[model samples]
Target: MDSQNSMRWLNVIANIGVLIGLLSVLFQMKQDQELLRVTLTNDYYTSYITADTSFAGESLPAIWEKALLDPKNLSLKEMRIMESQTFAPINRWINLYRLSEAGIVNESFWKSQVNLDAGYYLGDSYGRAYWEVSKEDWDDGFLPKELRDHIDKTLLNRKLNETLAYY
Candidate 1:
């Protein structure tokens, strides 16, 4: 074969090799995602609760119902308080994994990032729920100490910043 033809063939072979490598990489990623421990059963439950109740679990739903029924629990718009009892010990871990998967950290930061994420989610989720019940009457403050305590304004901001550091 002429030198020109030989060069063309080499270029074509290199391109083919790159395509195959990319396909393999994509397939491997798909396999890893498939291996994710997140189960559909749990997803179904969480989605149903969020969509129908504007809530996340049975305990919170039950408390909301009880609060609505009981006259003593009722108070002026801002003071009525109901407790949230999350269904499992799963919330912290799951939120951490979600944050990590979004590339919030490098592998070396995984442990600390996960810890911080737990604190972030704890205060944020409770604060969100409290806001829903109180409208805007409640200040930007987090939930009552009795309900959750992994966060303070200072610590929470630190966790958020740390999680975003790898970016």
Candidate 2:
């Protein structure tokens, strides 16, 4: 009877060992699956955020008019950002940046007026916004030629014609 009892105890121990081995294999498989998932997620994100190759590290200098006439002179990064962006009311500065690169937008250009509707439409829905420029930004050559000519000719002459002359 003692021998029989000893044999039963050994069988129970063997069964426990087999169960532990199976659990170990399961755990290892779970770990591998987790690792694979992480790798795939990382690969997807890496492909998503593409970097602009052109003007990646370029700076927009203040000489804006010169920059506009020579867009090819810009770095790839600058071109990419400008091409992709849409201007907003807050990004008045960005409009200036794009204008610098736009090459030609008529010879006589004016800064933004106080009203929001005072700007021109750019390609795509992204309007190139302007600032409500003070009188300081307005200079001799800035206003459109027709408007300037009319102001000088009509308004100035109106004043001259009002002056008294000897009959």
Candidate 3:
């Protein structure tokens, strides 16, 4: 082949190599992003599980049972026990909110979990009293707006559907 034709063919192969390199870098970046998402989700999941299992560690079930029956009737020690139980889950929620703010966790998933938990925990009068007391301990900006709103809605529903006390 003439020198001109040979040079043109070499240039084409070099361009193809550059394109391949760019594509591979893009692929690597996508994989890295996915791995980061999974790692963040796993961290949040571990925190959630720890918060739930903390009840066993703190011996909260008996106290929680009593508090549920009549929060107004709890002694100072029992109130403290309830307060301690409240903090673990709230701390996990704070961590989750931070992760959501950092864009490390999925906002929609966090929102759903927040709503679900609010429905379960704030479904009655005792939980509302516990929250009123325990919430004073949290720093400003710890709970996200979505979670706060969910709690508000749950409490409102509970008030609207008030049932006679069986205590």
Best by lDDT: 3
Clashing pairs in 2: 54-76, 54-77, 55-75, 55-76, 55-77, 56-77, 68-100, 68-103
Candidates 1 and 3 compared by lDDT, better number: 3
Model 3 weakest 10-residue run by lDDT? 158-167
Q: Global lDDT of each model?
A: 0.43, 0.37, 0.67
Error in Å for residue 76 of model 1: 15
- Candidate 1 local lDDT, 1-167, one digit each (tens): 69999999999999999999999999998776554534532553575356446444455545444443442453443122233222222243344344345654233333453344433322333433443454234332322332232333334454322322445
Model 1 misses residue 8 by how many Å? 1.4
Per-residue alpha-carbon lDDT of candidate 3 for residues 53-148, written as tens digits (9 for 90 to 100): 765555577667676666678889877666655555556566667777777777776666666565445444566766766666655676665666
For model 1, the superposed segments whose C-alpha errors exceed 4 Å read: 37-71, 74-82, 86-131, 134-167
CA shift of 24, model 2, Å: 1.3
In model 1, residue pairs whose N, Cα or C atoms come closer than 3 Å (at least 3 residues apart or on different chains), thus clashing, are: none
Give candidate 3's TM-score: 0.67
**Model 3 residue 72 CA deviation in Å:** 1.3
